[model samples]
Target chain A: MAALRRRVLEVLPDLDPAQVTDGSSLKELGANSVDRADVVTMTMDDLGISVPVREFHDVRDIGSLARLLRGHLG
Target chain B: MTTRSGVAPDGVVVTGLGVVCPTGADVDGFAAALRAGVSGIGLRPATVDGEAPGMRPRLVADLRGFDLPGRLAGLPQLPETTRRAAARVAGRSPLAIQAGVAAAVESWLAAGLHRAELPGERVGIVVAGHNLTGALAERARAGYQASPAHLPGRFALWYLDTDHVGSISQILGITGEGYTVGGASASGNVAIINAARLVAGGELDACLVVGALTALSAMEAQAFHNLGAMAGAAGADGPQQRCRPFDTRREGFVPGEAAGCLVLESAGSAARRGAEPLARVAGYAARLAGTSLPEPDLRGEVGVMTEALRRAELIPAEVDYVNAHGTGSPLGDDVEAAALRAVFGPDRPGPWINSTKALIGHCLCAAGVVEAIAAVVQMRGGFVHANPNLDESIAPDLRLVGRRAEPAEVRVAVSNGFGFGGFNTSVVLTSTTGRGRPSAARR
Candidate 1:
């Protein structure tokens, strides 16, 4: 979760830390499509995990995205 | 407005200049370095990524420490929104793209376009570079090999050379027309000519001619070195001494990296905006040698010089100075000197000549626009910069500036660019003091 949030903030430095709740979406935090993909790829690299492409389509929010990557770890 | 031939009768003027190179980061710093004969060439550090550990140190002039955010902050004149956009947009991009952003911002402000303002639909950008993905692709190779899916998604957009056009256009809000143009080493001049034509043809009121930094990978560097076209293999004394254009001791060119920008506009538009003109793009010509080889062609070189003068409607004797494409290679310098003598002649009292490459090294694809900025600097600053390393003249009768810079009121100057694979180009730039439309006056 922290890694996802960190990557999101990396792309949008102007976003307030309090607004980065897992329930919130990257789009809500002002991350464009390119920024969303960058954050996802960067987070994947940071966690040393590669989630399959189709699985990411199920991710509704930051929390769901983190949960999917964590499933790869477990 | 465009004429029946689709060319404007009005002149095109350079309204702004920017540079990010090893010699300096801005136009003012670059101008001072040229006047003092400062050489930015040095040994590429072995620790740099992708360099072999046991290989000999290669000579290169790198922009040692460029921080894009810091560079933007230094430009107090830039709007806060634009500065933030530059950082947010290109901070995580490759070094070359970041350098282009800095140069673009500097030139945008210098042109006073930000304060005066123009419709976003009327401004365009032309990026001068190709194969700009060498370093980034090489760096990503190992990562992809480890895990192919882990490659950053932004890589798709960033890898293309037109990333310069997209990023700069998005940041500057330019929407008229934009694309990347290539001519190998002559990319800069090609971009300039394209941008100038776009403005002259009335397709746009103004356009930015950006010379994107060429970040060569080790493989590309090794190829040039293996071909015996790069210095530092045998031309030793020091890194600075290796780039000796027009000198007998010159072995080959020393590679340099830089990005530059020029804002070219129609004369009437500039006057309407009360923008100060830097230099006039009086005339230019580009020709092919009909060969796909790497060697310079004497006929192509001489042809462009002659045609450029014909287009400018100025005689050879009227050309006050020449910013030569002397890359310090033995055969290349010999060919260029012969071309100069053929056009301007040995006994005819010709234009003073010097090579910006002697001080800043050869900037590969960016060399043309970088040297174009150098030519404008010398022209407006009232002096021709020194050749720095011309110990023995390749062309003694030519009035090449010696060890130190000299003062002269330069009105008309020729800036040349030649690339491998038969691209040859010459641009005629005239200072504000020069007459307006010599041929038009005759008509």
Candidate 2:
């Protein structure tokens, strides 16, 4: 979970690190559509995880994105 | 009352100038570089493998070490969130847009205009260029190189021409209508003329005319190469000699990229705001040959020049200088010289003529505005910058400026911006000191 949070921050350098949490909204963190795509791509490479891209369409926050990745890894 | 142009005395005038070119970033720097006859032409590294295997490096006039974020730092204060958003959006936006926005901001600042100072609904914008969305093609190419699935679904934003208008409008907080003018390389002048006419006709109070272009993609490079329009790989002679406009050994234009903006305000508005205008948009005219052949049409070029001079209410003999659209092509240079002769007639000494392309390569769409600014600079400085690379004149009848800046009193200057498909534009500019009497009273 910590690694997931770190990866999101890495992709969106403008995001306030203190504001990022499981409950923090990705949109509120200034993760625009392009930024979101970058985060997803980086996360996939870092975690060695495989999840359908469509699944990310509904993911709203770090917490939700983490759960989806965990489910794929499990 | 009517001015000599048959319009109100307080007609369209250019108040501020901004540019981001391979030569320089600011207007003053750009003009100084032009005076020194500095060349920005060089070999640009290829991002993609040569389409023609074993082709040498591409010769281009690129803005070296262009720092966008550093430029944005000079912009007016905005909310932190807004700045963050701009930064994020800029990261994904086209380089041309970024350069255009920078030029726009600088022009606005130079004009002493702020969003809070002017009514957003009254400010107008017109950005001109063809293929303004080259970044989309570049991104798509990068995506393919990375992986097919890496392409973003929202790539459509970068592919649309309107996106440029929308992005600039949003950044500038301009609520008025934004227009995009396309005319191949003549687009810059076309947009400027349109904006000036709009303001002169009372449809708008002021307008920002912007022209922007970025480095070409591999596909575009190949197309120019295929058309035999680009200088072949720099042989032992090197890239500097590749874009020698008007030189006897001239081959073709070296591709270059640039972005620039000019603030056109009605004389009344400028006076009301106590803003001293740089020059007057005295007259402009554009014509299309309605053909796609790469060959130069002397008749079309001649018509546009005569028409522009006629509109400016000046005889060809009174013109002090002409900024030629010499793209270093063998045929284009000769055709342009003949057109000047047909219009100016055979005199002992013709108007001083020179080409900026020899220094900055050919900036295509941005060439018009860039050269327009250069003409104004030369007029103000009391001298004309020579074409440093002109070893031999193709047309001995035309008095092309020599290899050094010469002292001359320029009262009026004309600039030519022509493009493929026979798109031709000519604009007449008069320095503030040499301005003629207005036939009519100010509005």
Candidate 3:
């Protein structure tokens, strides 16, 4: 979650800090397709892990994205 | 629609200008530095690549302290959407794209497109220069070497030269055609020719021609030094005196990092928006030398100048100024001098000749557009800038400006750009103040 948050903020520095919570979707947080892909790849790189592209289909929001990335650690 | 004093409602005119060079970040600031002949050349500290000493060229007119966010903030008149879009698209891009965006934004606003914009589909864009990614590649390599997955996610897009075209188009909301054009150091002029053709052909009413910043990597910089094409060891007079174009003691060119933009709009398009025309693109010509070697061609140089003047429908004598492609390279300057002699002849004191490279260093890919902006500013300001470092001229008979700025009625101006691999371009610009005739509609 922390890595994802950090990368998200880095991509959209103008995003309201308080609004970047577990409830927000990347789209709700104003990240377009390029920005979203960038955040996912950067977050995965930062964590030294890789989640397959197909597994991301079920990811719905920041919470789900963070959980999916966390599941890759096992 | 109401018309300004010297508006050309049908010709192609330069309605806006922008620059991000070692000289200045904004057009106004850039123009002031030009007239005052401020030298941006300075010695860069030498060091090794994590080991022994290196071979990079020591002298450079670097964009040392550039802060893009700060630059964007300085332009409070920029539209909110533009400011936001700029950050979103280019916030984490490479240095060259950042500089290109800064220049593009200034020109867009200066052209009054921010307030009363044309349809997005009607505005095209052209990014000039090539091999713009060596620096970015050099920087990204270490991270990739450490961990292939550790590279920045956007490195894929960032490494391409077309990023300049993509990012700027997204930020500006330009839906018209866009692409990159390259011609070694003559890249900027080639891009301008493309943009002008689009506007003149009525494919687009306005086009943005950006001179892509050329930031040489250590390898690239060393290559120029090794090739004896860049000034390396400065004499006792120091680095400032090293890049003395057209001077007797000139050695070679000094590489300067710069990005520039000129918004070329049809006079009818500009006049409809009540945009004031800074200068009309009277005529332009670009010719290629067949060889891939870096030799300067006198005949090719003279051909472009003569053709440009002829296209502008002006005789050599009517040209009030020439912004020389004088990069301080020994052979380059010599051939250009011979070309000038051929075009202007001996008897009359021809147009005031000077090299902006003497002040801002050679901006490589950005040279043409940067020098074109310098010409437009000089033509509009009614004065020619001085060659501050030229203590003795190699060609004394030519009317090159000396230590101080000289006041003159500059109406017709010709700016030259020549690149290695045989690209020679000359662009003629006439101030739209009635003294010089505006260009006719497409030929």
Error of 1 at B425 (Å): 0.3
| Candidate 2, B79-149: lDDT as tens digits | 45445545665645667777877787777777766534557766788878767666468757765576655
A best-first ranking of the candidates according to their TM-score comes to 1, 3, 2
Residue B296 lDDT (model 3): 95
Indicate the docking level reached by candidate 1: high
**Complex DockQ per candidate:** 0.84, 0.33, 0.51
Q: Report the C-alpha lDDT of model 3 over B328-362, residue by residue, as the tens digit.
A: 99999999999999999986778899999988899
The candidate with the higher lDDT, 1 or 3, is 3
Q: How many angstroms is residue B378 displaced in model 2 relative to the true structure, after the best TM-score fit?
A: 2.3
Error of 3 at B56 (Å): 3.3
**Ranking, lDDT, top scorer first:** 3, 1, 2
Q: Which is the better candidate, 2 or 3, if ranked by DockQ?
A: 3
Which whole-number lDDT from 0 to 100 does residue B159 have in model 2? 70
Using TM-score as the measure, which candidate wins? 1
Answer with 1 or 3, whichever has the higher DockQ: 1
CAPRI classification of candidate 2: acceptable
Scored by lDDT, model 1 comes in at 0.87
